[model samples]
Target: MRENRLWSFLYKLQDKQQKWLWLRSCYFGLKTTGPLLLLGILLQGLTLSFFQPHGFFYVIYRLDRQVWVPQANFIIHSLSCIVFGMTLLLLCTAVAWYRARLFSKKETIPSMVIALFLLFLFNFHTKRMPSARLGQVILNGNIPFIEVLFLGLVSAYFYHGLNKFLHFKSLWSIAGATVSLGIVLRGFKHLFNVGFFASLSGPLFAEISSLLGDDQTQLGTIIVREVGRNLLVWLGFVSPEQILVAHTDSDLSRANLSAALIKNNLEGLPHPLNIYSLSDSFAVLGGYGQIMALLLLFILFSRYRKRRRNAWQNFLPVFLNLNSSFLVGVPVFFNVILLIPFLIVPTVSILLAAGAIKLNLIPPAVYQVPLNTPTILNAFMGTNGNWDALLFTLIVLLVSMLLYYPFFKVTETTLYRIQKGTE
Candidate 1:
């Protein structure tokens, strides 16, 4: 009952004119850049799966390394930069155009150009050559979603606000004001990065880890970290792996693997509740927040054709555990409505998996798996082809479906109203 009320209150709050306008603008901005972001996600995944170390093209497919590696490297890096650059450019352009249309219709073109100029200015660094800026958007594991979203929104917001507040009639004056805003904001960003975030994040993480203790095998600790990572991702930050690195990489994961290798069985390895055993194998099906369940919900039941179509478009990528498309398109990022299930579904799934492991219904997923493996089979692969593990994975997914269905309905209804421009 309380959960329903919270969602109801959130929906009511979002229906207000100001909030709705912001949401509509964000949605529009996403429409402008969603395709490129999706492409970036797909390409990044493909590059990792086919070209990176232990990639299928090398490890599984046994491609000729000498011939393909160099070309693969060039193609992957170049395409990633190009796609990200295009997406970032489109995001700033779309936001500037939309915000300027709302603020001062006559100056929309200037606003857009200034927005692009600001993008170049923000990315420029005095110490590095121009091409080095491309490195910033290389679409590696650490995609700068937060930075891109922040800069695009802030640049456009400042442009609109300055034009509305100061009535800058001249494009030169507008440009100057924007330059000033960018300089000031960029300085603050640098300070936060070098000084504030540097000072706070490390110690803060250490403190949390200490509190969580060295024994990450505890299911409660795993649950907290899993939920925390999802929350961070929803807020558009990179999910910090320090909290819970993949089971394949962590110390506990190593110990578990070594033990399993020594025993030649899956009876009682250490760290059964580590991320690989639970979160990666079960909770994060279809990337963070079990988005596969939501996509399935959309494909099976959503009344909106666009939503259903989008579900299909993103399915293949999400199936391979690349979910930036839906994250940007439906924009689960910073979406409070979906945030509920985004956190809840994963938390519940982890708990269910942990319970199954505890009861010995299935062994913990201690084995290492390949990159870009189908998420449903992660547990099966990790458990050395354990059919019970596969069944458990499917059960968790069905539970996610049940948990996500109601929220999906709410999201579609609200989006329908937004799309129809109906208050």
Candidate 2:
């Protein structure tokens, strides 16, 4: 049976066209089904967050929740998945090909080295959180980290396959490699004793400082999500009316959107709101102008050592969803050139989502999803399992990537000029 199954897999790969289709299918499937599975998981989370607040089990369980469950919500998930997923797939394919092509390489080793060695050297020993709370400090016995272990293993394999273009025949080798990673990660310790390296912002700031001059530049101002947050608030999405009243055609429109009459005022408790669009969550794909995307772009695609080194140095912070380093580092704060898209992208994202909400095309994101949650998950959780919001967030992210592309290229040019003593 094993031999027969193996032969079938081999045969599928033997046909080049079939192989491409399979790969594309998997990518699309992930772009599509991954969210549906996450949506169902989100549904379960919505169910649980109400009952259990302080348990570690709920956290890990939801973190580890697979999308394979049989659930009634799958239908809802599937519909949104197909609609948004295909759209996202197209957008991503286009950007990656023309705009973001050769823009990023997921180099784990060099990045880790620069990030650890450099950030530690730069942080000045500013502690951010308790060792136990900071993670990486305590690698074992933290049940919440089970999610990390599995996620890391999966990511390691997925990226490995992508980077190496492994074939079906390499499945066993891949499995063996994954096991090896698990073993390695389990034994690894935070030997640098560098809490600040892990916690504090570093190298990206140097990159920004280099290009945009220094703190003396009036342009040294940083991006503060000034675009997305204020717009959503002005549009009444952030601050929804207490009661939603039905009215004439004009009033029934998306512009007249309102939230649930009751909000979770239980001191620290969070509840659903109907009026909040995904403005804040979708504002930045990976922080201001989705600059983390820019970091990855530079790291993988940049021809300059300055950019590549700084990008890798900041990659850890960016991946951790800490982007101020990149922002202040890039000095996107004051670079009028970069700042244009920095502000405009979020504004567009906010308006796009607000218009959608006004039209009742998608739901508002009222759930206070965990803060600093990355990308699509933010869309999912912030909307309280609303797939439309997740899809919309992705669309916003895609557009944001495009918006950032030209500016990124310009930044690269400026850096090149600086290198050549032309600027």
Candidate 3:
């Protein structure tokens, strides 16, 4: 009965309408830009797979004389930026127009113009405009999606507030208001990028290294720290490498590698539960949080054809360990139902892998694998072709799918209801 009540509460929360204009606008903006964001991510993934040195195609195919790859990469990247930049512009315009239309039809056009001009200033003054050459004004990978979402909603609210209260009519007044708001929000954007937790990455890495160095550090504590790192990535404040790749160069990793070489086996190493040995090997099946499991869920069970299509499109990229496609495409970034499984699956996978290692079922992954290695095979390759490690990874993936099933079902149901309502 209590479980049913909890489920009811969750569904109610999901179904509730946003009260604030900014919140509603943000959601609207995200929906409006969904296709564009997916396109950008697809191009970004293509660039990663085809052009990057450690990319899936590059490493796997061993292209000896790829003369065209760099040019193709440049074109793809530029196109991606154009798509995302336009998406940002459209998002801001959509929000401002929506808010202004709510006030008075007369205010909508001016509000959009103000919003666009302000965005121009925000980009130009911040040196993000013309990201490379020819005044392209693209939002590149450096600009996190969180910032894009924030700027869209906040800028729209700013213009809406002006329309609501100031009611400025003169051209000069509108331009002046835009410039002033742009300057202030640009500062805020800079500060938001340099987030509180982001600054702690250096110290956090040091602390985690110290903990790993301590022979008495328990496996449970390390798992907790790993979960914390995933939380940061989920929030889009920190890169997955900042925590998951924390101790790569440390003495612990080197010692483990050396020990593995000497013994020709992975068992009884000095460090059995480091981030790489556990998280990289097991937890990050498809780029942080075992995203492959979710992709599988989408392909097999999604009610919406769009969801299934995006899932199929995201499959190869995520399999190659480039998950930005799924991240913004399905937009798991700020999603509520998906967040639960996103965090839980990784935690459970890490625990299971750790348990397996402790019980001598499979040795910890000690060796470093190639960058483009399919995440499912990281453990197997690191353990020198251990079939057991490969089997264990499959087991973890299966478990993750099981963990993700309930949440994904809820997501599908919600999507169905929303689709019906819209139709």
Candidate 4:
């Protein structure tokens, strides 16, 4: 009788837990409804403003000239965008609040008043003229674009949803979100777009980074750009000819390709960006952020026997610098503990090297490098047989090692614990 009663008690407890989990998931899902719809509208505006997808997230070539709707001025567009945004907020928030029981009558009235005030402000601003700031924001990226912010925020919320979904043991919604992200999200007939992660990863430290200007070499800029860059690639944002132009013209990748014809002369017409060696400075040991160092460390020192063993076996492939094994083994993407450091290390390393070049402490790399050349060698070759560039990469490599160490250590322990069920 006692054993039977015990089983009965446990069953009731499990049922209660299941209910609680689903209830919480529903609440969170409802809360996200407004933001998700707002994000969709913002995405539409960005696509309209900058680049258009050729049916279902196809090749995203640069626009020769931005297209505006027929007979629409910036003011008209801005007003329409604002009006549509308000409609979304009203529709989404009302449904969400009703479902989630998120607001009291007392709070709802004030919230409605605040929403009305925004409507008035947007209308007032419409008459005042849409400032050139809108265009400026897109060009120089001086301010956070809603497109980028939306991606980062949605990724975070997706993770939040995943946690709740897992707690509730809801296979249905989990499959739905994942499948939808890849296929139905953009309505692309293809099964997946590589840019799916854009809305699912990156930009957790946005506020911290924003305080630092969105400079090319700033951590704040790198995190958003790192994720945004991949998304752009997945969206096929750059054409081969455009990439060629950018490589030859961009201060980052441009080398004196004519160095051989010019008798290795690296002098150039005066330009602020043209002065520094960028291609190799940005390329660390194996990949961006010099993650290979961490992989090496893991192979060498990981206490988890199985992980270290796998790393040891894969050393040569990783050394040859194949990207696949280490990416999954270290599991760099979406690993929250490592994300901040992954974003910061490359920027810090580049800034350090850029400063050295600026101060004439090192020779600027001016040669075009082979794309697959190893980083340390690229450092040596790209700088016209200079050893200092190699040394600079080594120094930056060491610094990256330091930055990544503690995070890797913590992650290793957490993974081990999870594997062993010790926690």
Predicted candidate 4 versus true structure: per-residue lDDT over 1-423, tens digit per residue: 995675455445433533453233322332333233333333333333333332111122333344652334345445434444443344323432332233233333323332233222222211335653332111111111222222223333443455445542355654455445534333432223454444355474454444422224333344455445433322323211111111333433342455433555444413213312443344345644466677777877788886677566545434433333344345453344566566667656666766776776666665654333445555566567787777877787788888887777767656565567654
Question: In candidate 4, which residue ranges exceed 4 Å CA deviation?
Answer: 1-255, 258-276, 419-423
Q: Each model's number of backbone clashes?
A: 0, 7, 0, 1
- Please identify which of the two predictions, 2 or 3, would achieve the higher TM-score against the true structure: 3
Candidate 3, backbone clash total = 0
Q: Write down the lDDT of every candidate, Cα atoms only.
A: 0.75, 0.41, 0.71, 0.44
Best by lDDT: 1
Per-model TM-score versus the true fold:
0.87, 0.37, 0.82, 0.44
Which scores higher on lDDT, 1 or 2?
1
TM-score of candidate 1 on Cα atoms, chains taken together: 0.87
Colliding residue pairs in candidate 3: none
Residue lDDT tens for model 1, 83-198: 76777677767876776677667657776777776666667655467655544423233435566555666656776676678777777887688788878877886887577766
* Candidate 2 deviation (Cα RMSD): 20.6
Could you tell me how far off, in angstroms, the CA of residue 34 lies in candidate 1 after the best superposition? Answer: 1.7
**Ranked candidates, highest TM-score first:** 1, 3, 4, 2
Ranking by lDDT: 1, 3, 4, 2
CA deviation > 4 Å runs, candidate 2: 1-225, 228-276
**Model 2 quality (TM-score):** 0.37
What's the distance in Å from true for residue 417, model 4? Answer: 3.0
- How far residue 226's Cα lies from its native spot in candidate 2, in Å, is 2.6
Question: For every candidate structure, what is the RMSD over all alpha carbons to the true structure, in angstroms?
Answer: 3.7, 20.6, 4.6, 17.4
Query: Judged by TM-score relative to the true structure, which candidate is superior, 1 or 2?
Result: 1
